[model samples]
Target: MPPKFGTSGLRGLVTELTDALVARHVRAFLAACPHGGALHVGRDLRASSPRIAAAVAAAARGVGVEVVDCGAVPTPALALASTGAGAAAVMVTGSHIPDDRNGLKFYTPSGEITKADEAAILAALDAEAAPAPAEGALREDAGCGARYVARYVEAFGTDALDGLRIGVYQHSSVARDMLVDLVERLGGTAVPIERAAGFVPVDTEAVAPETRAALPGWAAEHRLDAVISTDGDADRPMVADAAGRIVPGDVLGPLTARLLRAAIVATPVSSNTLVERMQPGFELRRTRIGSPYVIAAMAEALDADPAAAVVGYEANGGFLLGFEAPAPAGALAPLMTRDAVLPILAPLAAARAAGIGLEELAAALPARFTAADRLQEVPTDRSAALIAALTDDPEARAAFFDTGAAEAGLDLTDGLRLAFENGEVVHLRPSGNAPECRCYVEAASAERAEALLAAHLQRLRDRLG
Candidate 1:
C-alpha cells in the first residue's frame, strides 16, 4: 500500500483529495462499515470539507444508506450520534492540520474506522465500481447542538464547575460551539478567543507563539480554571492550566489516567518519564502509536474482562477515556473511543468529583517536561530512501551525529530511536501522510529538549540536504 490513507483517515491535500478519489474511498468504506443501518455525515469548517462530505453523502445514498446530514459539526458529535444509533458514519475533517489539506473520516457503528477496516476499504476499492449518485431524501438535524451539549452536562452534572471560567481558543476547531456550550452547562463562563479573520489554520504542529504566550493572560483576565480547545476536527485537545501555562498532551495523558484511576493503554513513544508518577493502583499498558493500535488493545483487554476500565489513549495532550454505566467495579468507566470531549468533561468532572482544582489534580502526578519537533517537508522522493537508510544503513545513521542520538551513542527502538541518560528520547519516522520526515523528541527541560530538537532538525536537514 502506497498509503492513500493516513493515521486516522483517507487524507491528502485539497488538490489531491480529488472528487474521484473521494467518491471511490467513501463508497468502499461505507460498504465495509457494514449495512442496513442509518448513515450520518458531518464535517468541519474546512474549505474542502463540503465537496468531500457531499461526495460521501452521495455515495452513501447510492447504496441506499439513509442519510442524516448534520452539516458543520465537530467530528466527535458525528461519532457520538452514529455510535449511539448503531449506525456507521463519515466525517470530513483534516483535523489539526493546515487548511490547505482535508480528508474523510469513516466511522464504524462503534467508533472510528479501524485499521483492519481501512485495509478492507482499500481492498474493496479495487473490486468496486464508481458509485452512481443518489438523490435521497435529506433531513437536517440541528438538534446535534443541544444533544451533544447535554451529554456533557449529564456527565459532570451542573454543580461540578460551579464557579470556573474556561477560555475557548477557537482558531478553527469544529468543537468551538460544543466547548462554549460545555462551559455554560457546567456553570462556567466561556470566553472566546480574540478574532482572526479568514482561514487561520490552528494545527498543533503550527500553534502560534502568541497563543502560547497569551495563555497566562487569558487565564488571569478571565479568572479561568483552565483553557480548553480541540484540533480542527475536534479529535484532540490543546489545554492550559490555571496558572496560565500551556499543558503539553504528554503531561496530561498520564495525569488523566491517574485521575480516572482506570487502566491506561498508551503508545510506546509516550513519556515513560511518567512511569514513577502514577498511583501504584493503576495499570498501564503501552501499544504502538496509532489510535487504532490503542483501541484494538483495549477491545482485546475488555474482551477478556467485562469489568474493564481502560481510561484513555494519550500519546499527546489530547487523551480520551471511556465512561459507561454498570460501574466497572462500583466506579464508572469512561466512554469507548478517544473523544476530544473527554479531556474537557472527564478531567473537569474528575476534579470536581475530588473537590480540588485541576492544578492540584495535575500536581499529584510527578512533574517532568516533554517537547516534540517535526522535521518537515522532506520531499516524497526522499522519504523511503530516508526510512530505508535510517533503518538499514549504519553509514546513514552517522549523518545524525551530534544530534542527541549520535551524541548519546544510541540506536533503534521504533524507527531510529535515541534514548538519553537524562530521561529523554528522540524518535524519527517518515511522515505517514506527507513527504515530510518527523522527529519526536521529549526531555526533562523544554529549553534543553527543544534545543536538542533544533540541533537534530538542522542535522537531518543538513544530512538530507
Candidate 2:
C-alpha cells in the first residue's frame, strides 16, 4: 500500500518506504515549496533510518537542493536547526511504531508543515515526475545537535537542575545521550537506566505494563528525584516522579503551562478534562487530536494577542511554545513544534520553585486521571462502523457499554467521545499510523480509568474477533 499522511506525517511499512518512494515524496515536498535552500535531514536510531535518510538526502540533492545531514538526531532538534537556518527539513523516523515500520516528517523553514501543505504534497506526488540531475552534494553538520542543546542550556542556566537527581531511561531513544548530558549540565545528577542495545518502541501515551512495573524498582534503586524518557524520535516525553508513578503528558502540559505563566493554553480534545479545572485562569482552546491542530489554535491565540504567553500540548505530552514565556531561568524562544525536553524540564523547575517533590507537584493538580490502550490489527473500516453503530443507536450504545444509562453527551471532534450520566468518559479513535483502535478513558481515580479502559478495549477486541 502507498504511504499516507497521518496525525503528524507520512508513515508506512519499512518495506514500503523504499529509496525510490522516499525520493519521490521528498521531491514532491520540495516541488510544492516556494523557495529552495539546503534541506536539513535527520533520523532516529531505527535500523532503517540511516538508509532512508541517505535516500532522502540524495533525493534533495538530485533536485538541485543542497543537503545537510544532521546525523541521527531527534526530530525537534532538526526542526530547530532548520527553522534557525531558514531551511526545510526531513526526519526519517517511525516514532513509537514498531521496528518493521518507518515514516518521514517534513518541516518548512518556519516549523512543521500544516495539514493543507500535506494535501499539496500529495497532489504534487500524483501529477508528474521531476527530472533528476546527477546527484548534488551532502554535507555533514555536527553543530546542529550542539546548537539544539545550547537552546536549553542558555535558557535555563547551568544550575537550573542543581538539586535534583534524575534517572534517564535510555531505551534506544535518539535523544537518550542528549537528555543525560543536559540534565548533568543543569547540575542534576543524571543516572542512566534501562539502556537498551536495540530499538524499542516506547509509546509515551500508552506505556507498556512491563515497563511501568519496572519503573518504581528502578527509581528506588537509583534514589531518583524523577525518571525521564521519550519516544523513539524524542518528540514526546514520558516522566515519572520519585515514587516511580508515571505522569501523563496531559497533566504535565497544563502544569508546564502554569509554570510558564501562560495566558492561553491549547490542547487536543482527547486530553484530560482536568486541564480545564486546574488552570481556570487561562483561556483553554481544545482542538481535534493532533499537533497540527494544536499548533494552528496556538497561532490563532497568539495572533489575537501578540503579547499573550501561549503554548500547546497533546495527550502524549509533546509540548509546543507558540511564543516566549517567562521562566525562572530566561525566556524560551517559540519552537512551534512538539518537544520532549521542555516539558520534562519545566515541571522539574516548577517543583523546585515550590520546594516540593515531583510527586507532590502532581498530587496538587486536579484529581482526575486518564488511561489509554489500543486493540491492535483492528481494521479502520470496522472501527468506523463500530463507532457509527454506537453513536447512532442508543440501544446499541447501551448494549456495547453494558449500561442502561443514557449518554450525557457526545463529542465527535476527532472521534467518538461519550460522557455517561455517571461521569465516566470513553473516547475511541482509530490509530492514525497503525492498524489499531485506540481507547481513552477518564474518571475520578486512576483505578476507575484503567478499569473502564480495560473493559472498553476488551469489548472492542470481542467485536473485532
Candidate 3:
C-alpha cells in the first residue's frame, strides 16, 4: 500500500514513499494546519530517513514555510522544539517498524495531530495552493538535542539516579547517545552495551525473542541494576529489571503515573487493568488504542477539571504530560506527545529515592500481568473477518476460545476484548502499521498471561495464516 495514515502516523513501504509522494503529504499537511512561519524536521537513523527528511524540507520550503532542520533526534524532542517555537513539526521515522518501511509523524504547534487533523490533511491533498513568492530559508537547530537532555535533568534533579548502575542497551536508537548522557548527568553510571553499527528495529510493544533472552546475561555480566532502551524513534521505552527480566510496558505506565502523582490518567484499553486496583483515587479515562486517542482523553479530563494533573500513556511505554506538574527538583512543562525519557527516568528515580530495587518497587503493586505478541504477515482483512465472526456470533466465540466457560463481559472499544469468568482476558486487534494481527492476554500471574498469549496466537496463525 502507498503511505497512508495509521493509528500513529503515515506509514508504508520505503519504495512507496517516493519523493513525489512525500512532498505531496508535506504540502498537504502545511495547507491543512495553521502554524508559524517555521517548521521543524527531524529523522531517525534508518538508511531511508535522510532522503525522506530532505523531501520534507524541500516541500515545506517550497510553500514559503521556513525549514528548521533538527537533524537526527528523537520524535518527542522534535515535537518539544517545534511546539516550543510555536511551529509545526515533521518526523521522518518508521518508529518500531522494519527498515524497509518508513513513515512521517506530523505535529501542529499544540502537539500530535488528532484524527480530525489527519482527515483535514487528506482532504487538502488535492487542493491547489499558490506557491510562495520565494523559497524560505533553511537553518539548523543545533541546540534542540541538548535542550531535550537538560529538560529531564533539571526537573528530575541532577542526582536523581545517584549510586545506581544502569545499563543502556544502545542498539541503533537515534537517542542512544542521548540516553547515556541523561543517565550520567543524573548521577547514574551508564554502561553502554550492544551498540549496533546500523539500524535495528526495536519494537517496545513486542520485543524480539532473542533480545528478551539476552537481557539477563547482559545484566549478570555487568552487574546492572537495570537495562533501558527505546525503539528506533525513541518514543517508546524498553526497560529490564535487575535480574535481566523485561518489564511490561503496562506495568511501567502505571508505576510512572503513580510516581508523577498524576491526579487524572488517560491510557489505552490495551494497558493492564491493575491500574484501577493500584490507583483508585486517580480519575482514569480508558481510551481506544493509539496515542491520539489517549491525548484526546487527556484533553477531555483537563476540560472537566482544569486543576487536575493530567497524564497519558500507552501500553507501548510512551508517556505524555498534559500539564506542568511538580517534579522532585523543579516543575515540568506540559508536552502532550509520546515521550520515552520521562517514563524511563521517573521510575528509576523513584526506586532510588525509596531505597529499593526496581523489582521491589514493582512487587508492591497489584499482581496483574499482561503479555502480547503478533502474527506477522497476516492481512488486516483476514483479522477483521475473524474478529467479526467471534464478536457477532456466540457459537463462533465458544468454538474459538474452547474454555467451556461463559465470558464475563466483552468490550469493543478498539478491538475484540473478551473477559472470561475465570478473570482472564484475551484481546485481538489488527496492527495499524503493518500486515500483522496482535494478541494480548492478562492473568493473575506472568506464566498464565504468557501461556494464554501463546495459545491464542497459535490459534490465530492456524486460522489466518
Best by lDDT: 3
Error of 2 at 153 (Å): 1.6
lDDT of 3 by residue, 39-99 (tens): 9999999999999999999999998999999999999999999999999999999998888
lDDT of 2 at 248: 97
Of the two candidates 1 and 3, the one with more favorable TM-score, higher being better, is 3
List, residue by residue over 24-54, the lDDT tens digit for candidate 1: 7877877665743577899988878888888
lDDT ranking, high to low: 3, 2, 1
| Per-model RMSD to reference | 3.4, 1.5, 1.0
Compute the lDDT of residue 315 as modeled in candidate 3: 89
State in Å the error of residue 98, model 2.
0.2
Would you list the C-alpha lDDT of every candidate in the order shown?
0.68, 0.88, 0.91
Instruction: Give the per-residue Cα lDDT of candidate 3 at 430.
Output: 90
Q: Write the per-residue lDDT of candidate 2 for residues 1-465, one digit (tens) a residue.
A: 357789879998899999989988999999996424779999999999999998998888887888989999989999998888899999999999889889999998889999888888988986565665656567888988778888888887888888899999999999999999999888899999989988999999999999999999999999999999999999999999998999999989988888888888899888998887874567889999888899889888878888878899999999999887777778888899999999999899778777899889988888989999888777778888888888889778778883234689989998799888877789999877787789988888988888888888889989986
Backbone clashes counted, model 1: 7
Q: List the candidate 2 regions with Cα displacement exceeding 4 Å.
A: 129-135, 402-405
Clashes of each: 7, 0, 0
Displacement of residue 359 (Cα, Å) in model 1 is 4.0
How far does residue 175 in candidate 1 sit from its true spot (Å)?
Answer: 1.2
